[model samples]
Target: MKYPKIRELKEAIVSLLTPAYTSKFPAEPHVPFEKFRGKPSVDDENCVGCETCANVCPSHAITFTDDKEKGIRTIIRDYGKCIFCGQCEEHCITKKGVILSDKIYDMAVFDRSKSIEYQEKELLICQSCNAIITTREHLHFMHRKLGPKAFSSILNLNILNQKLRLAEGQDVSVEIKDGLKRKDMFNIICPNCLRVILVKYLSKGV
Candidate 1:
């Protein structure tokens, strides 16, 4: 109650009355670092199918298969066992860039077996012809690259038709003749085949 005893009691009381300094997590959110690892992404348009990412990955979380004849490749990413090493992103062939996201960190699940790898469908791309035969959008993309004048050439049209017929069968046609007055019907090949036809025509000098 006096001198040293009084001072010690007062100090203890004051400390107990002071506000808590530690974080109240549920009441207040915690902030993470700027480069937090979230989900991974791939810009398919830029991906050259090099498989460099799969080769360098320490965890073997990435897999890529190449189609030599078509010159197209497929990639699959397994995020379950991913170590967030950033090695894949570093080795990616895309010059634009690849980076981790801040969204999917809590994606872990109780089913370990099911969490292994999710397969994604890949597009079959032609290296030399640059044809996207699988989907219509890819066909349009190829056509856009080839442009109009080259697109309309008769030889190119016939060649394109031949390829389409070979792949889609002879029943499919893309030919059209005459105008609004005297309409005619015909079969036509897709745009990719058209370009190939043009190349053949030029070589023949016909």
Candidate 2:
């Protein structure tokens, strides 16, 4: 290494004088450029726990679990597996549910669990078949989107009645114990069971 070529010497000098292309992240604060895709931030007020993010996530970073007994739906977001593809932000039904943040991008972590997040919403379980219905928040979101048309469905009407407490202390679950009867219409029955009730009983004017 006694003698260096003229081109090599010139290249060395140029590199030494030029500003670094890589930023000193830990040593200095760095602001990302405009339209930079970074961490995905959630707006809980607008998020209805619809599982739409989980469905569209290519990396499977988002997951959902429902506990029927507790009437709760848990949403899990593992940032360690996230590719920051912006699919969650793009397909969000509410449009304001999830969005990728441009400012906060530092996600370095030693433990994987530290990068995980959990959120819970009330589940709207079917009282008849015990089937897993959508979350209460999701139904409310649909009600807002559908407006007056939402009342066309008996399930939505029952949910609205429960929220408004039209009957006050009257128990809607009283007749659900016997079977899928006409009275089950007053309770939180699923669309399938509601269809059965209408076809079998209501059609004959029971």
Candidate 3:
């Protein structure tokens, strides 16, 4: 028993002399390990303001506000409510739009507002109802992703081309094509109006 106690004491002394395995956080910069999910970052240039990140955020940390009168869409991300989940990064249409960064976790702030990040983009209005439909960049992104045939069934290519032209500040006119013209309106239609028109058109077998 005495020898066992002496051996235990010697082991404790050796441990005390050995280097610490625990990290000295705060005193020294703490580097996060590989695949560590930390803060989320958004690249506005690639984001297109799709609202996918806001919709997929499990913590409800991301929010979107649309100002129709001002033709602006505002996206807000609150790091204080973020759970460091990678959902936003995974579901982003453009992979480069959102990403989980390995940045240090020093998010302490005196004012809670300081932990919030905001981004704004211009909105595209419906040419018919004048309602805010989506962002200009988002329409362009969809056009690039889906190509000209994407909206062929629901919308005419000529109309879509006119919409793109209108987005570029070009003057264009809406002409009746294939006997399908809605008050000579072209460019874009609100979802509600589109649904109603599609239902009526389908019922007519045209």
In model 1, the clashing pairs are 156-194, 160-193, 161-189, 173-187, 173-188, 174-187, 174-188, 175-186, 175-187, 175-188
- What lDDT tens digits, residue by residue, belong to model 1 across residues 48-116? 555567788898888865553443455667778688888878777554334566754555467766555
Q: How accurate is candidate 1 locally (lDDT)?
A: 0.53
TM-score of every candidate: 0.40, 0.94, 0.74
Between prediction 2 and prediction 3, the one with superior TM-score is 2
Q: Give the per-residue lDDT digits (tens) of candidate 3, residues 19-115.
A: 9988787687677888788888888899999899899899999999999777899999999999988999999998999898888567767999999
Q: On a 0 to 100 scale, what is the lDDT of residue 12 in model 2?
A: 94
Alpha carbon deviation, residue 103, candidate 3 (Å): 3.7
RMSD of each candidate relative to the true structure: 11.2, 1.9, 5.1
User: What is the C-alpha lDDT profile of model 2 across 47-156, one tens digit per residue?
Assistant: 99999999999999999999987889999999999999999999999999999999878887789899999999999888888887799999999999999999999889
lDDT over C-alpha atoms for residue 117 of model 3: 96
Overlapping backbone residue pairs in candidate 2 total: 0
Ranking by TM-score: 2, 3, 1
Q: Is 1 or 2 the stronger prediction by lDDT?
A: 2
Among the numbered candidates, top TM-score falls to: 2
